[model samples]
Target: MLTRQEITILQELAKQYAEIASLPIQKEKRNMWLKLNTIQMERPMVLIDQIPWHEMDVDGFLKTKVSDPHWRGIEWEMRTAIYRWHHMPADLVVNPYICLPRIAENVGWNLPFHAESEVGQYGGQAQTHIFVNQLQEMEDIEKIQPRKIIVHKEREAEMLLEAKEVFGGIIDYRWGGFSSHLGFWDFISLWMGVTNCYIELMDRPEFMHAIMERMTQIHLEEIRQMNELQLYDINTNICHCSQTFLPDLPKEGDIAVSGNAWAFGLAQLFTSVSPAITDEFEVAYMKRIFPYYGAIYYGCCDRLDDRLDIIAKLPKIRKISCSPWSIPEPFAEKMPDYCAMSVKPNPAFLAGESMDEDSIRKEIRRAIAAAKNYNRSVEFILKDITTVRNDPQRLWRWQEIAMEEVQR
Candidate 1:
């Protein structure tokens, strides 16, 4: 419930959002993203992101001089979206819909150790550390159960009606989260501490296999459950490794299944593991899971220079992530013609005492030169930016360099 003043402010923001979403340029940019994702010829795309907003140097980024905390939070998100559209180089859509979920909630059995991270003094960028090994023994795997999803039918309908009354003409209302981006190995690493999980892979191979087998089934069941509930919104276009639109979607009906949308997974915890171990544990299970998806976007922050071959072999793998540590030349060479190369440039370029324009240009040039070979599809996703050194302008400059390369 918003006060009259707050409602007025919100509706004004909604109008601004509507204006942007209705732009002719929006449609053109969208088509470009769709073509790039579908492995067609187009200029390289760019997606700039800063994971933790507190780490950014943008003054008053979050703070709004409002008495009501709820309205302030809403203002924060709306303002951030507006700021990103104006500043960042990403192909962001001004979706006027305030999307709400139709499904209830899924709560998993609690693991003993929680996911934790430590933020630095400069900016609130966290150094994550997981300290749990719930699956130390084979017998512990029995405790795993499929999450029960509860649908809030009355509440969902009430909210949708209220949204229609308040922002019906200005912004649309819709239900989202029909599809999912699930990762089996990523969850396993969290349940079992990363180090212990790695050691157990070598020590207790059978046990790891059993856990993966159960985990895969659990996810498959969960996905089917969404379909059974009829909460899926198939009309919404989602952005995964690529910007997916109506044209890129499968010809299937509106059902909540992996084959309906993009599925992304990453095992950054397995970054240092040997290829053999990787193949036995990670690759084998991923093959089982990825088959359910219409398209796949594999790897995140993890350097896939070593495991690119195995990942490239997966069914419907559309985008392969090239993290900061991955050498672009080899990644470009190995990236399948059918798939797009998604590059995650190092964010460290902006974290130093000052912006290193020369170094940044050189690195961008290298990536451009490598991917330009054979005109392979490429998208530069600037992510993992932990710090901006109290200067958000560095990000804008970096985008300038990247967009320049695209034109060249």
Candidate 2:
């Protein structure tokens, strides 16, 4: 149960959120995102990530005090959400109601893990030594089974009713898995260890193929089951792909299926592997998974400059991420017309002892110019920023520079 004080804090935040959502600019931004997503216009969108906040000072803003850990976590999230929307110049649409009581049907099963990292770390920015792999032997693969989506109806309803009572009118409640970042290749890397997985591709070719085949089956089955159960996941207005919103997507009432929402896939772990190897291990199975989605976003922080030929073959891939390491000049020249380029600028500009606005501005201008030289549809996503040296102003400044370059 929420305390009287917690409820008051939530109510206050909801009012502020409501004010932003009610802005006419919000709808304009929404329409612009729709245009950007459909590849009709070249409006550049800016998306600021939540990574830097982990190392920044948020003390002065977190005024709400809740003794319970869960409630305190909620308070902290609300504070961050309010701060980012109000401060950052990203192309974000502030909805009239905040999201509360969000829930997903627990797919009753667990992907066995052999190695693990400490929480709040290994967020893809830092590389760590793999210490575990549950599948140590070939026989262990049999333990992997198809997962079933277990919808806890009573618990989901109880939480929804409670949220409605608290801020039902002030904020909207969404249910089901609307956003997914689970790329089975990454899941494979997690279970098999990066080095071991790569080595097995050449050494134990048959074994690697077997594992990939099973992983593909599990992922496809999960998606099919979720849709069959009417698990609704709406991405129509959500910024899952760059800053672009999925305008023609499912609603909260529609059935949750891959055909209605955006699905993301990448093989960043296969960065060092040969394109042919990646085609067999990563793209081959991804072909099976990508067909299920209405639209797909591919590539992460991995450099895909050389592997573009292989990736172009995947189905329904609409946006490709041009990482900081990817050669922007050739990437701009080679980007396919059917898909938009999502550029992920190096996050290191925001980190370290001191921030370099000049260097940051230069790089942003260069990236933007490269995209324009080829008349490519592009969006700049500033993410994977591990730390900001506890400086919030750096991100704000970076956003300003990025937006300026976009408008230029």
Candidate 3:
């Protein structure tokens, strides 16, 4: 139940959101994104997501006044959207709708682990952790099982009804689903420690294949159930922290399936693995599921410069992440022109004691030059931002610089 003050605050934010959504720039940006995604260049786009909100305290701009935990989340989202537009709008499309996700309970894949991390100022962000490996031997592979997704349709309807009652006329509300981040090896590293997994990959090659095979089947079943239930949210504006306003998704008034959306896959843990090794383990399994989506966004923090050829083999490969660790020139030269290069600039530049404005500008320019030299479509995605030394203005300034450079 929302209090009167909470309702008032949300209502005001919704009105502001509606106003922003109604802007002419929103449609223009949407068209630009569609062009970029389809390999028809319209100029590069820039987006800043995966921000460290805990470190941002700009005159209490991110603080929430709402009391309830659930409503507080909604309030925080509304505030963040409005705040983002004011600071680093950067090709973002402010939608006129709020999404209510279906209530789901996932069972199976009962992998156990014990992990420890230091609690500090930026505890909410990523930190160094010590994990206990749960999978010890090849025989332990039997423990993994296909997950069962149970959606509570009645409860989902009730939540949607409540949201409609709150902001029905002020803003539209729709049912949204989770975007796929299907990385089997990434999960395996958590279950079986990174060192152990790598050793097994070299020594017990058969065991590694068995594990990959099982993980692939588990994910396929999970996605199939989600598709059958029509729980996949393909109507989203963002997919894996990049613009998803392409012309080929979320079929109108039809049940949403994996085929109607963009699916994200990566092997961040396999960063040190050779191209052939990655092909056998990561790419082979991921390819099984890649065909299920309308398009695929592959790679993450991993440096994929060597495996561009291997990654190119996947079906519907639309975009590939070019992490900060990757050399822009080589990747740009080799990447398929059909795929958009999702360049992830280093967030460390913002985390320094003082902002390195010159380096930041140079880095963005380097990416731009590389993409232009190869005639590849590109988008600057500033993400995995762990911190800004508690200075929100650092990120704001970076966004300003990114937008200026991309436009030029």
Top-TM-score candidate index = 3
Tell me how many clashing residue pairs each candidate has: 2, 3, 0
Question: What lDDT does model 3 reach?
Answer: 0.84
- Selected candidate, larger TM-score, 2 vs 3: 3
Ranking by TM-score: 3, 2, 1
**Candidate 1 ranges beyond 4 A from true positions:** 55-77, 96-98, 115-123, 128-130, 231-242, 250-257
lDDT of 2 at 176: 33
lDDT per residue, candidate 1, 57-166, as tens digits? 26664455445553455466567667777777466655546555554776553444565554446544545675656776777897787777788787667656655665
Clashing pairs in model 1, backbone N/Cα/C closer than 3 A = 104-150, 132-193
Task: Please write out the lDDT profile of model 3 over residues 185-296, one tens digit for every residue.
Answer: 7778888778888888898899889988888888888888888887777766678899887775765775678888788888998789899998888878877889988888
Best by lDDT: 3
Candidate 3 has a TM-score of: 0.96
